[model samples]
Target: MKLVPLTDRVVLKQCEAEETTKSGIILASAAQEKPQEALVIAVGPGGVVDGKEVTMQVKEGQKVIYSKYAGTEVKLEGEEYIIVRQNDILAVVE
Candidate 1:
């Protein structure tokens, strides 16, 4: 099964959380914060949405930063993914 986003929705695979701090202190699982960065998995074709013409700026395989607390979590075939609106994506990592 595959995910096909509709309208301006986007699919992403989240990057793993860091287990240790920059100072070299190992953190517990509960203390690790989820990273906002993710890899673009799939993207929806952009068109008229909410009466506005939208164009997709992000592409599949691009790393991106998304808004915190955004998107819906999905589990597919033992793999986890995130689905969010294109607007929820903040920036693309170079």
Candidate 2:
């Protein structure tokens, strides 16, 4: 992928959770409770800082959970994606 996020923005590949519940309950696509968590794919170097470029704390492949409504959606190479800032990310998953 040739995607290079600008400023502190980061490109995240959303990970889809299972469509079925473990208790044998099937959920419809429209019934999803939250946006799937994601992985850090390509991240911007971080926003400008005091006249200098700051580096982001997030690295590629790191798992993160963000607001369900965050990010700008896009499609690249026929796959969907989301671009959000490092600060927008709520927490890093283990």
Q: Residue by residue across 16-59, what tens digits does model 2's lDDT show? A: 76577888997875678656589899988776855777779888
Error of 2 at 88 (Å): 0.6
Which candidate leads in lDDT? 1
lDDT score at residue 52, model 2, on the 0-100 scale: 72
Candidate 1 per-residue lDDT, tens place, 1-94, comes to: 9999999999999987757678999776567778899999999999999999999999999999999989999999999999999999999999
Report the lDDT of model 1 for residue 27.
76
Worst 10 residues of 1 by lDDT: 26-35
* TM-score against native, each model: 0.88, 0.78
Clashes of each: 0, 0
> What's the C-alpha lDDT at position 42 in model 2?
92
Off by over 4 Å in 1: 25-30
